[model samples]
Target: MFLLLFVVAFALTVNSHSYHRNKYITSANFFSGTIYSWKSDVVGYFKLKERNNALAEENRRLRSLLAEARDTVPFIALDSTVFPGPYQYYPAKVINNSYSKTKNYLTLRKRIGDPIEADMGVISSKGIVGIVNKVSNKYASVQSILNTNSKINAKLKNSFHFGTLVWDTQEPNEAKLIDIPRQAPVVVGDTIVTDGKSTIFPRGILIGTIKDFNLSNNQDYYDVTVQLFNDMTNLHHVYIIENVEKEAIQEIEDVEVKAPLQNRPTESIEETNQENDAE
Candidate 1:
């Protein structure tokens, strides 16, 4: 009887003490919280790939919407049909990339029916990647901008001064912009972008920022160094851009090239007048 009374008195004392009760509650919570944290970490580790895929898909969708919003210009046709954006984007995964070589290339895994073709532009969320050079049934190869032979038309983001973008094979993240007139007001940290001179990429797609500049050998043009925005060595997901009107534009260009000039003159007017005076 005396032991039972002592046990009841101890229990009442422990329960009545706020510090002891709070300590017990804190210990229980810490134990449970640790277990929950471990369980969540394990589950998250298992679901990492799935989550990455979901995020990639979400990014693709958001990019499509953004392209439509940015590129769409409404025009009323005779049939009253609204035309969509001229460029189509397809999400792809990088299967292989090579930046160490003189002519670096990247292989992409695309859906079988994705309509990916050579000359298409490849880009990441940050900036330009390369141009598609070859395509197979389910894969395409890109000529990365880091390659020595890569030449893209790029311009200043704030002005119309344009030049050809090339890589010097010295650094993976640095490229050269040549043929820009020396008169251009180029400054360090100025943004460089695609000039849209060709159908490969749209106008104003980011390329990089001007790192430095110097006059070329002839002193007629400026050779500007650009620091790329995209890390060329660490690429994963990319978007393949296809210009829908590429064929039609190419056809028109070809015809213009082949067409004969009208009202041709075989002799100069000055020569003709001199010959007439001699006669």
Candidate 2:
């Protein structure tokens, strides 16, 4: 009798478990079918939004390319006395950039095809950025004015005692101009600009204003505080300056041609012997 009772109990438990399992599978199937239908309808909406976003991004990129092409084309201004010249603008975008640090750098998407290379200055409609350090066909890197590696000639609004404007990296909006003698008579609000000492950049480009400054305890030069003209942290569009004349100027300066000596080698030796004999 006990064995019969046990058998009946086991049969009931097995039946009960099967019923629950069937019910769970039925509910899950029903719920999943509903969800699938709803997902199909909403999928189109999300995809449309994605497509629009992609289009906008592509449009921005195309416009940037167009501008660069215009600059790179050889264009000579109307001049009666000068030969044909090249005024090229290589377009590039600021893909990555660093600022708000003591040192900063900017990376651009360009290749050797862009013909941009080291020592080329960068700028935008806003203002100057920095010089090019490295370039590849599909990418280029810039040394931002905010970077400690950056060094460029800058001057006061009306004065010509141009030193160098450099990024301290401690402040994004500010840079430092060093080696201005204490006698420059600089005021707190004087403006600073590129002095055009190098062919990479044109003269009179806006830099910043003399916010304030002081002299270091032991240095003869005044440490000037400058407010940068551009918001480098939010760089978007930029132009890689080709300065068509830059290469020619650099080549001329780098030439190792022997200059005529004031005293020839033989003349110098004879003069030295005569002086020694006299002594």
Candidate 3:
């Protein structure tokens, strides 16, 4: 009889208090939400690799389409032969990267069987990354643009003035552009791009924007600071660019021409005077 009376009192107390019922419902919802969140996180983690692969493949396809579109000409005749473009791109994963050294390098997961070769240009979606220095059957090493020895031909996007791109080892995301003649117009926030002087990188490939500028000690040219688009410390995907005509162009340039002193043309008096005056 005592146990029955206690049970009835407990039930009446719970039913009389709306706070107790609301607290019970809130606790149950919170516990379920946490469980669902954990489950979602685990599933997402497992699908990460798949998602990345899909994204890379999609990018490759789009790049190929763009290349083809650029190669195409309006009102051109269709032929059975497909002429290859001057540049070809191959996607690769950056397995290792280093940005905190005077001479930093990156390692890529490309094998010897791949069409990649030394001196080829490497770029990410945002901007230039580095150049391939060494390639083995299992991997390839890149000389990062952040390295002290890195140099590439870059130019002002709005003008034809070109300069040499170099790193000062002071900052990973910043680089220096030297040898820009004083006559060229320069302003902060101007875009810099590859000059297409070499067969490696094509013209108009983005390098960075001008952050600051000053005349060098000699005062013959301007020294410009560039802020890179890519975060050198964090990298994952990159594309290796191969110049299809690089070999042909290099071979033609390698042939040395020699002329006997007797056959060499002499400078005219007027030309000599002009050269002296310019000097």
Candidate 4:
């Protein structure tokens, strides 16, 4: 009998709430809309913390960028600066990245509008990401240094001796800088940086440190393994460098330098006809 009374009371409370809900459901559109509006605002309050966190991260990135600019040398326009050294910058963010495979690449959010083109891209924070291989309106792809095809001119920080930095086909963090003169003191922990010889990256840009070294019996240079500074496995944002002078240099090299003619001239049809007529 006590259980029956409790059940009766619970059913009455549920019925009362159901009647109120039904009344609201049958209410005019304006009344229902107002309630829903309030409900939506309440739901939005639940996501306030997440939204705040994202904003805070973006703000931090901006502040860091400002600090970097202030501390670094000012960026001079190509038209104003002269160079046996030419360098430029095109900032970008890593939208997609991979580093585990033997082949790797990073897709950037920068596009053609940003003055970024093929073979022009250097990471600002991480030193070098890779050259831009392809570009669309709002996207570009980079061939990461970890890829087998990637090569950068690198040198010992302490010595002027230089070499071609390449992959060893074994480790992601390591690469080989072949052709450093055997005289170079390549200890197990020597730091290697981008050689100013190439326009692809800035001089003194950190590449890696000498992880290990071995000299071939007849080789002129030591075989060096470098431990990279940028962990290719996890990268977020990078800066792209666009050498403003690159276009002019390319034009001059393509136009001014002419290959020497063959020792024996191959006769053209018009030349042969002229010779025959003269004969």
Candidate 5:
């Protein structure tokens, strides 16, 4: 009788567990689904960083192509001992940029020990960005064209009229091209580009389109509002232009500037006395 009772109790316990088997399985499945969802979110978070890096690289490549197209000597082998190119471009990532401030600036990620230096021109695929103002082993700071103190030599894309590009601290998308001759043909859609007057950038590099134009206060020249091609508010990749002959050329130019000042004639003592006597 005790053996029979033990068998009956065992059968009842097994049946009870069997009846609740589906509920137990469902709970386990729910837990597994929650864990899997969390894992997917973690993987996606890491993938976003990879995607950003890839996009930056792609932008650099495209900007390189644009630069090459404008290059007078498009076919250059950098391995050659004597490089004939006046300007060499180095790709950089824009780590930080400021546009809202009156004196905007940009920071680029240049590898440590790179040849980047102050005063180098910076441009994006669309157009000119800024000039390097400071540099370190691993990074460089640029004076944005939108800065109040920033100025660049720019001109009409189809004409020889040139002007000084400056920021009015009004809009990030716009800048002023002042000292342009009023006689120069200008329209709402006329394109502006670098004049190649300075060592910073090559001639014909796109700057922007003329959004509006009016005479200056003195009415001697035109003050044009230019809509930049590159969105100043958003920049990802840029090219740092290194003018290979900058130092040598600057030395020569400096001497030339000082030469005129040093050569000015001094008034002779006798001539001064004669003038005094005449007075």
Candidate 6:
């Protein structure tokens, strides 16, 4: 009789436990879901800045495309050909940047197939940034304009005179434009821009404005100080410029340079002796 009573009591206890479980299951799930959603909202809030930066980059890309469509030019000589859209700009985030040192450098996050390579020009939305020095499959390093070894071709905006842009390792915002012919009119506060003399930068890209100028030591040129547009100490997003015709132009130049030597008649020993005899 005692065993029968114990079995009956155990069956009643199990049924009671099942009833309580079914009653609380819905509430338990609701609470868990609410907590998860709250955590996700917090995470998203913290990511707003990154999202804004990405949007800004996209806008700049659109502007670049529009500019390309408006400025397409036919092929001409290497330097004279207006590269309209010959350059492809790739947006990259500045993963690391520095300007306090004399030789400042920047690192960007980019992949191998992303159209970036060594010697590519880098620029910000406001103005020039740096040039790509090295690249890996997923990253690139840039040599900042603040470097002592950095030199770029620049010119006065209102005239045809051009000069070489260099840094003095003295100030972050100031750079020197040397070799400008003194004949070219120069005044303080005049605009300076890229001369497009090289394959790196396009003509008229704003570099800076003249802060001061003086006759160079050689007295044949003017040395001008330029105040940069972009703040080198603070950089976030940048564009990497890839010249589509760089390789083709380089190949053509190589052929043209080698053609003269290859076609010139080499002087034989007999010819040399005759020339010496004539002298």
lDDT of 6 by residue, 47-119 (tens): 6796578568768987998788668965445664556677788987666667888767676765448977667
Which ten contiguous residues of candidate 1 have the minimum total lDDT? 19-28
lDDT of 3 by residue, 1-279 (tens): 999999987866564332211222211133433453455456556667855875687589779977888789554566747866799888876766789887777777653377887789999877899988766555667888997778899999999899999999999899999999999999999999998878889898889999999999999999999999777876667889999999898785454122223354633544664675455
Q: What are the per-residue Cα lDDT tens digits for candidate 2 across 26-105?
A: 11123433443355446545556644664577578779977897799866555776744544567775656667665566
Model 2 quality (TM-score): 0.60
Candidate 1 deviant stretches above 4 angstroms: 1-81, 260-279
lDDT of 5 by residue, 55-91 (tens): 6876798799778876867665577687868999898
Can you list the residue pairs that collide in candidate 6? none
Which stretches in model 2 have alpha-carbon errors above 4 Å? 1-87, 255-279
Report how far off residue 228 is in candidate 2 (Å): 0.6
With candidate 3 superimposed using the best TM-score fit, by how many Å does residue 25's alpha carbon deviate from the native?
65
What C-alpha lDDT do the candidate models reach, one value each?
0.79, 0.69, 0.77, 0.67, 0.78, 0.75
Clashing pairs in 4: 90-240, 122-241
Q: How good is model 4 by TM-score?
A: 0.61
Total backbone collisions, model 1: 0
RMSD of 4: 21.4
RMSD to truth, every model: 24.7, 22.7, 22.4, 21.4, 23.7, 22.3
TM-score of 6: 0.65
Best-first order by lDDT:
1, 5, 3, 6, 2, 4
Considering TM-score, which of the candidate structures 4 and 5 is the better prediction for this target? Answer: 5
- TM-scores of the models, in the order given: 0.68, 0.60, 0.68, 0.61, 0.68, 0.65
lDDT of 4 by residue, 99-175 (tens): 77765666666534777766775674545667666565666667778777777888899978888988766887778
